[model samples]
Target: MATAGNISFIPLTFILSGIPELGNNQNWFAFPLGALYVIALVGNVTILFLINREDSLHQPMYFLLSMLAFTDIGVSLTTLPTMLSIFWFNYTQIYLQSCLTQMYFLHTFAAMESGVLVAMAVDRLIAICDPLRYAAILTNSVIAKMGLLILLRGLCVVFPVPFLTRRFPFCKTHMLVHSYCLHQDVIRLACADTTVNSIYGLVAVLLTKGIDSLFIIISYGMIFRAVLRIKANEARLKAFSTCISHICAVLVFYVPLIGLSVVHRFGKHASALLPVFMADIYLLVPPVINPVIYSIKTKQIRAKVIKLFRRREIGARDNVIATI
Candidate 1:
């Protein structure tokens, strides 16, 4: 704790404000939030299982997708404990060290997700623009290296945040805006100068998400140019169709992300619930939606999922007959 003109501040624990509008009725949100968590967990796990079980999916594209599934799971798991505690149990107090740990994983997973998306964009660019070299360029070894680089980049970039956040003395008002700890939200509670933390946070976001988005856009531009060059309309349409799932994934991840950032940075006068809602959407929607989009848009995944269920049905019927 620290002193500011006879006032004691900087409590060891922070209180989470879970949907201030709901107040005592916050428990009502537990059902929907729990449902979303279940969907995200089941969906991403199913994608990973399908990708792993199918030998035909042992390709660079599917490999990147598996990485995305892992990242989504990380995102979902990072916030689940705190969100559940706040909504279900009304347990909102979080220790300083614990908050920092949550902030680290949350930001790290987010950065890693952005990195995976950029890698996916590059994968698509090579596949569409230079089909002959796609196999040569994105070998298993190369993909493995890319995955390592993404992990390392996330680790290095987010490693400083906890330390930076720990240096500040927080104000007496220990209430946080959301159920889970966030760098931006935590920094705002500091009574001391937070310029360094703020600038570093912005830099981290720019270096990761901003650069990743730019690269994705450029890759898509190249893909479009290559697709347009195909003389046959059918071939052009086929090439374009392959990107639909990825496009949807990108939009799902980035749109809510951008909205949340905008609300945090510029929407000072906006409803308190708006930022909270945006944050929830940003974190929850992608995990629940990405696997669904891929399953629906990618024929191979859809077919495999259908085949898996059919086999399960057959096995159940066989067991029933044997028992009878």
Candidate 2:
């Protein structure tokens, strides 16, 4: 413990309790969790690669999707090392600085993900409500600026979290609830008054995810009204169909997020496993599922993915024939 003052000691490291109830059985989770991480990385990378390789996918929507994939990859990579270390090797101890850094990146990526979703919603709104001006409205330069703004927003919003967490003297037991460091989880261990931390955390959430969700809802509502005005049922259905994948992405991301927040705030007496499970779902599900939803629901993405696989299969067969 490092002495912060004459009377207080700040521990140099924090211990991560990876599902305390599981105990020795925590190792059993290693394989499944590792597999999910691997899938997330591969899926998101594939989405990005397809978007880059396919010229038809160079539109505003796919550009925002590539951003989303990049964010997902960041989220997975940020949590993978520490999480696997805890579950696979029982190396639950994380240095104070390391914990704070992880917390920063995790929250930053989360905020970026939210911003990308908002951009996607706006893309859909324009496409549905004003198809003629869609290309003019969301040009490549404009998309680039949006991406830059989202990155800056996330970076600026989360920049203070680690510093805030660092200023506290954590005299409470340094055992964190999850395998990875979270802002809320870390602040809870601080010995000092955390009213500021709590308020700031709430404010940060409201500023990023809250505002993003509101915009998305409003965008979709407008989209719905626009779609309804179309005289043909076929045209209305087609407009709605474009949103299926994004809607799924939003649900997957926000549903778990809401559940986790609810569990954190209101489920104190609830099963200890509840928060752990909710957090896992909140963090892990989006990255793994988003690509699949997009690939399945978005025709262009699905066709491109199938075409890529078919080309690989054909190349493999040609190589075998040459060997024979």
Candidate 3:
């Protein structure tokens, strides 16, 4: 597809795919996929609303949780539209520019989530390890700065991905394995020498997810050490309880991601459905699960959600009585 001097069309579209094994049954898959999307949307939105309405929750921990909720919404939006299109309508065509745009968003939000998780871990460390200094260290201005730094880091590093792809020639097959456009998934299809793209992709992963994960591990290590030093077992348990939700969030995000990476690099001979499921879990599972974990584990969120539903039920009953 290269012309003189290796120049080509400005925007070359490609066909996105779902599980080929399902064949005509792909439409049936839309129900569960749609349900996941709805759950993720409702859950994250509820988290955001709870954080916004509750003055008591206006702290560094909740601030970082709100940021995490925002990133979860972004992660869901980046992939859900195209995935629904493919599963429900069989609309598989995505323009080159559009694909790159999707990749940018999906990866950016993924990186941001990692950063937010690390921030939450640090918050927990301070709250547990040095409770007195927590307020002084994580002031409102400092939290604001952390949020901005996360955003800028996510956007700036992944900004060049699409531009780099533009320079390469996609002379090979244009078919992509997943419903969503991932940088690693798309870059392997290029015809030109992809050494630079591959190197950059590795570096990006290491810088964002890799380093963030390392920091999270270290923070938790410190937190557990601090908790162990407490004189009373009850006090230790209470302190450790605070980190359960965040620990769950970290697992949900990273486990599927690591599985997907392994499947991509080593499981070429594995079932086609394996990779698809891994990708789906990586993208969809965390957003849906994180909110539920928090709601169940954190008393504040649980109480608010219960009150929210009870209010709705009461309003409905009053409306019925008025009509009668």
- lDDT (tens digit, per residue) of candidate 2 on 23-52: 877898899999999999999999999999
Q: What are the per-model C-alpha RMSD values against the true structure?
A: 1.4, 1.6, 2.0
> What overall lDDT, based on C-alpha atoms, would model 3 receive against the true structure?
0.90
Error of 2 at 97 (Å): 0.6
Q: After superposition, how far is residue 133 of candidate 2 from its true place, in Å?
A: 0.5
Distance (Å) between predicted and true CA of 183, model 2?
Answer: 0.4
- Model 1 residue 29 lDDT score: 90
lDDT of 3 by residue, 1-324 (tens): 435444343437877878878876799999998999999999999999989998988989989989999999999999987999999999998988899899999999999999999899999999999899999999999999999999999999898888898777764468888998998788778766888888898899999999999999999889988998999999999999999999999999999999998998899899988988899889999999989999999898899899989999999999999999
Candidate 1 worst ten-residue window by lDDT: 2-11
Reference-based TM-score, model 3: 0.96
Query: Once superposed on the true structure, which residue ranges of model 3 sit more than 4 Å away at CA?
Result: 1-11
Give the per-residue lDDT digits (tens) of candidate 1, residues 18-113.
Answer: 999988888989999999999999999999999999999999999999999999999999999899999999999998889999999999999999
Clashing pairs in 2: none
**Residue 153 CA displacement from its true place in model 3, Å:** 0.4
Better of 2 and 3 by TM-score: 2
